[model samples]
Target: MSHSSPASSASAAPASIACTSLDYVWPDGTTVFDGLQVSFGPGRSGLVGVNGSGKSTLLKLIAGELRPSGGTVRVTGEIGYLPQNVTLDTALRVEDVLGIAGTRAALHAIEAGDVREEHFAAVGDDWDVEERATAALAGLGLGHVGLDRTTGELSGGESVLLRLAALLMRRPDILLLDEPTNNLDLYARRRLYAAVEAWNGVMVVVSHDRELLERVDQIADLRGGEVAWYGGGFSAYEEALAVEQEAAERMVRVAESDLRKQKRELSDAHVKLARRKRYGQKMWDNKREPKVVMGERKRQAQVSAGKHRIMHEEKLAEARERLDKAAEAVRDDDEIRVDLPHTAVPPGRSVLTLRELRLRHGARVDGEFELRGPERIALVGRNGAGKTTLLRTLAGELDAVSGTADVHVPLRFLPQRLDLLDDELTVVGNVARFAPEATPNEIRARLARFLFRGARAGQRAGTLSGGERFRATLAALMLAEPAPQLLLLDEPTNNLDLASVRQLTTALESYEGALIVASHDLRFLESVGVTRWLRLDGGLRDTTAEEVRAEMAGEG
Candidate 1:
């Protein structure tokens, strides 16, 4: 269903994209990148890095959304950029969002025989703009959607696709997509993946989606304000990274050994020099030779001792430099370490119950579910299917439309927005608010495991990066009073990078409780060892990961 774009044609030479001596500094005095240089040729390049490593910032700079402090981004052709979070006016018609309202209106006027010079000018060369727009929507699996429909009528995932359709209509030679599949459902993700696969232009995508990354021609790993190029897709990139890390670690070990050996040699040199000085002084006091001969011997000995000391010092300095260089190659991404023995539920216990549940939004979900022990349930459904509504109802944040949802155990719900945290409070203060009984020392100790040590724990939550905020929120929930025995998470990996996702997974691994997670990430759902899968359409139905994948594959 995809419409052919002008930029999709292959040529003898590839398009050029380069940024030289890029420098960016935030208003809050935080520097993201300094003197960074990178170039991307025509092909799919998957940009990846840990959270807060300036992946989004770099995209913005290239797209002209943000200006670099000092540098130039050169692109040989037209560029189309899709930001991470797209917010369209709810009242705006789909045509307006697609940037073709003027052209469509002109065409309509001409068809009505009111053809003015301005209308003709507006219609210019895009006589088939409406058809192109329709095709673009249909290509993304939104075939039923029309141009006159308002944005509010579409689901969150649908809105994302609509924005992407607008970008595609431009047919830019270079495309910049920033976390395009963050909140997309399985069907929408597959549609997006298909579009990526068909893209023949230069495409730079910043995402943690494994499936999407696997489609890329190369991976540009952004770390320590530098880019490391790896040929092929994410899997190949990971293999290369593993080899590099192994070599780096070996160099570190060798450097450490050399440093230790140099230190010992320097110490021995100093001791020998001291002994020679003492012996020389004793010989001089005894006057074993003439004064002139003794003076000559003393000068020679002093010169020899000085040279010996200088050589050992120089070797020690070189060893220290080698150690520092070796250490720079190793990455030390933090991991959450938690022991939640108190949150354990007995195997026979009933954790939750849902009886004829209906959400306020008119979605009737009737089910009877009982959780025993630490059963992990994965909630899968399309956008606006009432997954978040159900989680909120279970957390007592909202009232069920008709039936009741009773929680037999202490529960905590982590919404996608992460608004539960008080922005005014520090990380330690927020956790303390949840657990007032815990002492300051105890809270600090717990926060340390969440990778907020000392001053970082005392900083305001609003100042933390996306990954840090997630860790802080997770810490608050896990360390809350009564120890949450039933944990609810909604799209936990929506905004997290791959490393942060792994960290969150590690945190959940130690959590001994019944868990319910609403997510569109199939890989993540599988990674969490989900015990059950529930699809929320009109009602809940038992499903499997394979079925979900098969269903998406069929739709695609």
Candidate 2:
């Protein structure tokens, strides 16, 4: 890939992007990047960072979706951009999104004996636009979707894949995707993974999806207003980061020790100077020495003390600054730490049961389905397979089309939309709404564990970012009035940062309750200790994560 020679290689590549002295600031006066110099050459690069790290903003700038506050972005070839939040008009057809609607309409018109010059112009030389569009859609696991299907007919995951297919049909030289797999199911994500793997042109993806990042040729870590390049994928990046963090920590310790030593030396110098002054004063007061001799001695002592004091003070200041720099190098990866003993369920207690369950979105449980004990279940399926419908039914937020979904324990559901929290209230007030009996102090103490401490807990829910809102909603659900013994989380990891996902995993570690979370996040499912894998396709069936991965890879 010649990452070392980005200048030469990127210039020659048909698809490339270069950002020179780039700067961006939000409308609210929050600075994201300043004088950021970055370039992308041929081959895939995974752009990763913490939430609000400007990865997406950089992509937008490159794609010309946004104008940089300062600096310039240069790009070669046509760009295909799939933003993090995709909004398509539901009234549009598949061909419209794939940008072949005009050509298709023109072809059909000519076939109907209206051989107009306008039709010929619209068709151009692309008589096979329909074929190409179909192939693109099929390549992304949308083969079953017809060209006439409305955008409203597709699920969220399908829509994302459709957008990708649209981009592919354009045959753009450069592709920029921001969190492309946010709502994708395991199967849909596999299609994305394959697409990313097959990308030969320049591609820069901003994603937290582990599997997707693993497919990239390189990793560009955006941090502290600059980008650092790693030669390999996510695993290699992690290893490199671990090594760097370890060294940074060591440097911090050394700097701290040096600062302490300097402080002590400064203190000791003060004490010694004071002692000398006392002795000199005694000599002067008692008239034990000649006046001229005493005066000269005192002057010498004052000069020497002043020099020593200044030297010691300067050394201390330098040490403190060094210590601060060293500390800055160390990353702050705070995790959620909480215990939910009240949510614990006994070993053999029944949590939830479904009988002949038929969801509104075309999913059905074949027979009596029972979840007993503190079972951690991963509900896997394709989009529109009724995962949300099932979760909502169990939470009593929606009634089943026809069947019984009984919840024997006090349960709480974290919906995919995260619409449970009131926008007007603060995080404290939101959680307080769920735990009405709990005092404000008690609620604040619990919220602190979710990384909402002090004034942060008072931040309004509406003002919270995607990651913060996820945590706040989670906190509310986990700390509800009765304390959910059975939890229903629908894509809980969606739009969450890596740290927030880890926080969720940590929080789940302390939870001793039954859990049925419908998510396609393979790493997340593994991390949270999924006890069972239930594939809710035509009917509920037991499956394994490996099996699903194999199926997605076309191996099964």
Against the reference, the lDDT scores of all candidates come to 0.86, 0.86
My TM-score estimates for the predictions, one after another, are 0.89, 0.89
State the lDDT of candidate 2 residue by residue for 1-556, as single tens digits: 0111123454355777888888888664657878899999899999988765777778878887778888888877678999877778999998889988888999999999998899999999999888888889889899999999999888878899999999998877889999899889867788889899998989999888888888999999998889899988999999999999999999999999999999999999999999999999999999998999999999999999999999999999999999899988889966666555467789989888889988876778978999999999999888878788788888898888898988898888888878899999989999988989889998998889878998889888876756677788888877777778888899888777788788778878778999898988877889999999998887989999899778767687
What would the per-residue lDDT of candidate 1 be over residues 375-445, giving only the tens digit for each residue? 99999988767787788888999998798788998888888767778989999999998889999999999
After TM-score superposition, what is the CA distance of residue 13 in candidate 1 from its true location, in Å? 11
Candidate 2 runs further than 4 Å off? 1-31, 34-37, 61-76, 285-289, 338-341, 421-445, 453-463, 552-554
Candidate 2 steric clashes? 0
